[model samples]
Target chain A: MSYKQVIYTTAPDPAIDPSLTTGTFRLNTVPKPTNVPADKLLVRTHYLSLDPAMRQWLTAKRSYIAPVEIGAVMRGQSIAQIITVGSDLSSTFQPGDWVVAYSGWQEYAVLGAKEVEKVVLPPGGRPTDAMSVLGMTGLTAYFGMTEVGYPKEGDTVVVSGAAGATGMVAGQIAKIKGAKRVVGLAGSREKCDFLVRELGFDAAINYKDADWRKQLKEATPEYIDVFFDNTGGEILDACLARAARDARFVICGAISQYNAAKPQGPASFMTVISQRVTMKGFIVFDYAKKYPTALQELASWLSQGKLKRKEHIVPGGIEGAPQALVDLYKGVNTGKMMVEVAPVSEALNAKL
Target chain B: MSYKQVIYTTAPDPAIDPSLTTGTFRLNTVPKPTNVPADKLLVRTHYLSLDPAMRQWLTAKRSYIAPVEIGAVMRGQSIAQIITVGSDLSSTFQPGDWVVAYSGWQEYAVLGAKEVEKVVLPPGGRPTDAMSVLGMTGLTAYFGMTEVGYPKEGDTVVVSGAAGATGMVAGQIAKIKGAKRVVGLAGSREKCDFLVRELGFDAAINYKDADWRKQLKEATPEYIDVFFDNTGGEILDACLARAARDARFVICGAISQYNAAKPQGPASFMTVISQRVTMKGFIVFDYAKKYPTALQELASWLSQGKLKRKEHIVPGGIEGAPQALVDLYKGVNTGKMMVEVAPVSEALNAKL
Candidate 1:
């Protein structure tokens, strides 16, 4: 059996908003290889992970990691099945076994046995759910807060892009970690409502509001003690103004400024001096070594029914992929923004 | 016998460009130590230390430390002679012993014994030299480089305000630490020449040039690995733009921005994310405990004549103090700005 691979085909991205992710994957049908090379395994992709970082990876610039070349399939974390295996890469399963691999943006791929970890799915869900709240997005929020944010009890915690996968989980984590107030800044009223009503955020401020700065201060009267900033730019500047003494500003993502012609600088940096603030930027993949612990904690919270997972699943094989990528930058998707290839059950679709 | 104490008095500081300075400090002194109690120590001030941080202290707002209140005798670091040590608070020093203390513009002061620390003269130099080359300024150069800059052997270290007291020393230290290139950024062609010819800086760029930004890039081809910034504002913004990966930007002082009604924020701070830079503001006083080690090392450097001590001393008694500070803010001072209340030697005659 053979499958298709989405590839970066052109460099005609608009200079103003230069992420022209057009979905038209290169499809190929060839006989499956029977003789695998040493340390090679066949992976039947169960779910493909889609993230905004994929856009950055499309360009061959000096990003946290190298971008995907024009001819290669885009890079991502994937869950797959073992269709066949060679003797050297053979494990427990003879021909059929469920496994998680990082063979990205493809229906099926060949991966080295050591290249991917077998994610034993939780009792409540499938692998697609594991790719989100129970996976990297959840872990990114987990370590960013506990390690970088380090919010103490009664500390005011602020999160940017609040209704997104990471922000939603981060704000809730801060609350669970005994934050006195957890304020979130989002782009729209719907996200604001989701943050406050669903995620238990103490307050949510739409950054689109001109009075957002005032609302932010009001939401955080004591000033923010720890700011888990996923989206940087004016919101980061506003947070800088209201940062309490010794506030921790974690730079998880700068989604707001990433696509601009000239990136936004921190305007009120003098506040960092007056407030003795510490701002640190990190790549989520750098902390991949600690994901198991992060996943364990997130899974426990999910299993206890204390945590919620919401994903905006976009369907179609690889045709909707490019639009999904463009829509992500526009903040069109409501939640985790996953592209589904195969379905689990129709009853599981009821939540959507 | 009662000797009339001399008090420096300025009618008021005349305004220059408000953008360059918030305002000038008028050194007004009342009757000095006329009511010195029997248990108090009457100390005669000899030398006053002038620094950029002093300008910030004179402003009526919070900085890293509390601002000096208006109408109080302008605060300064002065090396003074204990004229009369009263019986009540006497132990560490006797009358006539030289000591270092925060004695302002007045020629004589009634100080508590606890307010003075006896100046232990080193083997080779006069005590007032202690305030610049071997005192707080030297320590500022030390910690700002070692703790913050952390320049590796092959890394290029750039120091702004490069001909100033701290900057000159910081560049030498970076060279001593085996830096590949040490570049200096100064305000004049003469200062740039002096930095390159006299100080051993690899290249010197005059920030006064119309095309200084281009000159800076030329001087530092690979980009600055460690930026020891004293002059902030546009210079800081430029440095941020030219920073290398994992650059350390140690903001010792922002003399250029200090007087501005609104501090200019960095235009290219997003470079911090791209370059993985870390910018931090630090005051030398916080590292006061390391003064001994810093002093010992600097004293050795001075004795060997490896370190140069250039004092732009004003000739007068306490009356010259206010104008000396004004000249510093005007960038008129050649090197370490200081006010001589009395002569250092026979060649430096007593103006009084």
Candidate 2:
């Protein structure tokens, strides 16, 4: 069988601005991966998670993970359906099982058992949630907040990029954890409205406004206690300026600077010293051992109607993955940006 | 009785380069503070500690501590001898007892009993050591290393401002803690030599050299596991680039940016995210409870000749305190920089 795949062709030019063209990835028709080795399973991609980390994966620079090699399928995480299982791993993963895996930007992947996690969603939970709130995004918010941010009751928590996938969930979690105030910094007025009106953020500041700094100060009257920083640039500097004494600034993601030809540091970083703040940069993979507990709690919150889930699903299967990533960088998505290659069964959609 | 004191007259112009004139402090002669209130002890300053923080105190801007008001004595830490004890506190302190106190840039000060800690130097220890290796500098190094930096055995620990008060002690502590390669960044070849020869740093790079960054990379070939950053600016950016995975950056000071009109933030701060680093800025006051333990351990090290002590003592009484601070900012001092206002008794000086 033939399937579609996105192949990385060349490294991006850092001198030029990052865009769809910066990714040098091309869609190609390829034979579906077959000959599953012993202890491996053959899976078909259903939904591909379009994340900001994809930008880093395309760069030649060393990061937490290696750069995707040229002529290889673009690296990505996907919700997949097991098509065939090798005899060695037949008991662990049988045909028809739905799982989340590091399946890359390809329709079909032959993955070892360890590469995929069998995602068991609750009743009425969508498999797509596993790619968003129930998977890496939600878990990233959970551990980064509890472990690094260390929010306390009556603390004023400020989150940058608060309308994005991890940011929205992080603010909600801060609110749920008894934070006195949860202020969000988003780009658009609509996203700000969604955060405060729909997502329970105490207040939201439109960072694109000329007086966003003033808005941030007005919103966080008592100063910030825990700062969940997703966008790292001027917004981060503004947040740093208002940081309370001994504030914890969790460096979850720096989406704003990821594409910059020369990423400028926060100008108000002096507050990190004046306020004696702890700024920690972390990767969610560092907390892999605690993912189960985080997932269970997130699932509980979702079932109880305490947590909301949203996804901006792009069409065109594997061909849309690259463009969806560009849209993510442009802040066009309100929630988890994903490319849906194959739809789930009507029964599964109805359950959700 | 007449006494000499330095008074801050105005805030400095950040746009102008900082000099002795930048600090609008004037030496004044006034009647000694003779009326020791109940619960207070009158102290005659012996060694006035001139710290980089004194520069911040001169500014009207908000910091960890309140700014020294115009016409008020310049704020400083000092080693002093009890001159006259108030009857109410006669049991706690007596004349001729040596202590460390927030005596400011003055010849005499009336301080409450709680404002000072009695200095009980080890046998054969100099009273000046109380203002350096066995005092706040040592304490800053101890907690910033053990609590924040958390240098492990065989870890490459890099320290900036290698020959300064806190940096020297911090690097030595890293060595004492069994760090594999302890590298230092200093301003001059002499300071670098002192750090390597006298202070036991594995390697010392003169940051004033044209190829300092390259030297840093070479000195820390395996990259830095822990970075004790004292000089934050371009040197900090260079160090951040060589940070190892999960490196801990203890932000003890930013001496390099203290005088800048607009301190530039470190450009390579994204390395914090890529390397999963924890950069923490701390004030020594936060670890007040642990001072006794730190002091005892540091004293033990000094007594056993494990830790070396160096002091750049500026003479000419309390009048020199202002100029000594300017010298501190200029990186003229090799170790602790202090102004010796009054001569210590012949008996105390003999102990050196």
Candidate 3:
């Protein structure tokens, strides 16, 4: 069998430009592995998650995670179906079982049983949800808000990149936790409107608007108690300027700075001291032990309709992974951005 | 009776110049406050604490504490000897009692019983010790290290402004708490020597040295775990680059930025996200409730010789307050910087 894969070809010169292109990654066809190791399972990708962190992975510098080396299949997390199980792990995973795996930007992936997690989906739920709201993005928002942001009752919580996957969920969670007002900042007016109308945010400021700072000031009249920052740049500075005493800034991701030739530091950073604020940066994987409890609460919220999930699905299979990531860096996605590789088997869907 | 007082005449233009000058202050003789209010006591100032926070108080901006209004006495925390007490508070304080008071840059002050704290000295201890080792500076170092920094037994702790009032005490406290390596950054080689030899810091880097960054890299071989930052500028950026995962940055004071017209933000601030670090800014006032216990522990350390105290005593009494403040900003002092406004009364010394 033949499977399509995206491979990292070159590291971008952060000093010159950091635009993602086919020159940096190449599409290739390769023969699928014929024999799986006894402890491994073979997964056929259905959905691949395209996140801002992928841009960081393409760089040569050391970060929280290792860089995607040249000539290597690009790294990503995906929801895949176990097409075949090795004899040693046949009792653990069976054919047609859906799992969340670090399957990378490829149509097929071979993984050890420990590398993939079994997805326990709700009735009538799609497997794609397991790669988004019930997976890494949702868990990122969960721990970043509750643990780091520590939004208190009657507090005003401000979320940047509010229309994105994690921002949308983080704002809603703050509201559910009794935040008096939840304000959001998005790149476009339509996304801002979606955040306010669809996600039930108190107010949404279009960062693209010339009067966005004024809008943010007007939206958060009492100053922000917790700022869940995903886009860290001018928006982060504006938020810092209006931080109340002892405000908590949860730095989940800096999507705005990810693609910059030289990431500009926030000018109003001194507000971290002047306002006696606490800014904490964290990764979702750090709280792996607490994932089960987080998922249970998230699942309950989904069932009760207290939480809403959104995903922007790109139509092309594994070959479209590069453009999907490029579009993500351009702030083109409204919610979770994912590339659909294939449809899950009816048997797997029915079993879930 | 008459006493001399320093009054703020004008605010400094931080953009043009932030040097402390007598041009912004004037010394004048004033009648000593005599009639104590029903709940107040009359106190004679002895040792006036000149801190970096005083520079912030001169600026007409909102901070953790209100700025000193122009034409008002310069605000400060001081060790004073109570001279008389109101009838209502006679039971709580006596005439010869030493107390820590918000006495400002003056020889005499009238304060409410609730506004002043009685100083309890160890046997054979001088009243001057109360202003340095067993007072606000000591308390600040205690809480900022234990509460915010939360150093572990084998943690690599870095302290900036390592020879200042709070920094000296903070570094020692980290050492006493069993930190495996305590590295310090000071402005001069003498201060660095004092930190390493006198205060027992494992290593000290003279930030004024041409190769300070190289020295810091060599000193903190395992990267910093808990960074008690007192000076925030390039030193902070250098430290951020070498921070360990989940490192704690206790922002006690930004003495470097205190004088800047526009403080420069750290360029490597993204390390906060890349390393999953937590930077917390705090004021000593927040831990007021726990001061007594901190003082008890500090007093015990002082008596046991586990902690050493040093004070740069500027002479010329109250008339020298302005110059003393300027010298402080110039980094002329080694440890606690204070102006010796008045000598303790012979009667008070005999009573103790």
Candidate 4:
């Protein structure tokens, strides 16, 4: 019997094109392991997450975490099912249990019990929610907005990459936190409309438009009090120019510059001194201790329909993940991008 | 009698050359005023303070304060002596009393009592202390370092424009507040040595050197915990590359970019995210209500010799003021730059 896993090969050529023969990643077939260690379990991957931060992981440079080494299984997070339990773990043994783990891009993985976190679904929540709104993405939006951005009542809040997973939730959170007006920036008219009509954003601007800068200026009449930036290029520069006195800039990610060989900084960065702004950057993992309490609130909001979810799930198994990731850089997904490697029917049957 | 005042004539031609026949400013002869209003006092200018921030005031753009209008007396701060007291302010102000005011560049002026702050010298403190370490420049360093930078014990601090008025004090304050090592960046070897030897900086790098970046790296083995930036250009970019995690960047002045037709930002600014850095900008006047307590503490430090003062006084009177202003942009002064418009004989005589 055999299992398949994606292996990292070459580094990015400024921008990633996974279809090339000498691309950054390639799929490899390997013999399935027949043995599970006494303290380990064998699991089958059901869904694998694809995110913008994964691009940062491909570069051969130092960051919050180490870059994925060549010839290694590509790094990832996924929902998986227990296929077998170890003999020494009989007390806590579980087959057919659903859990989340950093299992990488593979069909099956052998892991110790401590390596996976058992998923306990909230009322009216789905298993996929654990990989998104009730998981790291949701937690990032919660902490970045409330803790770093500090959007106040009546403050004009602006968010870039507003249609993406973390940004969508961050924009909605600003609204729930009592911001007077919330504006979102996206790459297309449909995404803009979806943000305004579906996500309840007060206004949404298509940054790809020729008059986008002017549109941004008109949208932020009182100026941006809180700017949650995920795309760090021209949009960040424009926002910096329109920053109000004592504005707070929460730099969550820089998706726009991730592919560039040499990323450019905002030209209006000097406005920081003139306007007395505070620009801070953070990684979501820093708030690990507060995850549980945050998930409860996120789950509550999802149940109440105050928060919404959009999943762009591809279904051709692990093979589709690399192309999906490449499409992500092109703004191809409306929301969270994921690849379904195996049938989630077991969890769905249990839910019923 | 006619008194001289430097008049702002034209906007900067990218850079100011006060010697230009058609320049940013010109010396104008004005007839001396013969009358003093009941609510105003006549004062003779002694020493006028020149600062980098004055350049920002020359541009016809909206900022924290209105720009100096064309054909107006170039704005300045000065230590002056009251020549005659207003009828209404006789008890509050009298002849021979030394005071500080935004009295502009001129020999004499009439001002309401409210326009000037009374100067009360601390024990063993010189009257010039009011123009440097005990004045606005000192307050800028205090509030910016303590409230913004928040340098912790066992931390490394780096300061640019390290020999200037605010940066010198800011670097010393970091030391007094218990920073383990302090580094200073200046344009000349002499300024660097003065900083390391006389100002107690642990290391001083002359930024004009070809290997200054290598010197900076060798100086900060622990990386920069706090960066008090006074010159914002390539120096800022260099500091950003060596920033420690959670470093605090106090954005004070950007003298390097003050005259650029198009100021460039730090190319390595993305490190703010990778390192979870916090960069904040502030103005000293924002803490006006707390000035009294700040001044008392600063005076105590000066009396104890924990804080030092240095002044570069130009002595050809008001005529020397224009070229002095031009030389400021060239980093001519090692410390606080000022012009001695009139003798301090009256204040000195009163002390006897």
By TM-score, who's the top model here? 4
Recovery fraction of native interface contacts for candidate 2: 0.66
Residues A218-267 of candidate 4 have per-residue lDDT tens digits of 99999999999989988899999999999999999889989888878887
Give the chain A TM-score for each candidate. 0.89, 0.94, 0.95, 0.97
Question: Arrange candidates by TM-score, highest first: which order?
Answer: 4, 2, 3, 1
lDDT of every model, 2 decimals: 0.74, 0.85, 0.86, 0.88
What is every candidate's alpha-carbon RMSD to the true fold? 5.1, 2.7, 2.8, 1.7
DockQ of candidate 2 against the true complex: 0.68
Runs with alpha carbons beyond 4 Å of true place in candidate 3? A15-22, A34-38, A60-62, A343-352, B15-22, B32-40, B84-94, B344-352
**Residues A204-274, model 1: lDDT tens digits:** 99998989998998999898899998778888898988888778888788778656666666767776666
Candidate 4, B45: how far from true, in Å?
1.5
Model 2 agreement with the true structure over B238-286: per-residue lDDT tens digits: 9889999999999888888877888778878788888999999988989
Runs in model 4 lying further than 4 Å from the true structure: A346-352, B346-352
Q: TM-score per candidate, in order?
A: 0.82, 0.94, 0.93, 0.97
Write the residue-wise lDDT of candidate 1 on B180-266 in tens digits. 999999888888888888888999998889999998888888988999988887898998888887788887777786556666677
For model 2, what is the C-alpha lDDT against the true structure?
0.85
Ranking of all predicted structures according to DockQ, beginning with the best and ending with the worst: 4, 2, 3, 1
Model 3 lDDT tens row, A112-186: 988799889875466788888888899999999999998999899999988888999999999989999999999
Q: Report residue B87 deviation for candidate 2 (angstroms).
A: 3.5
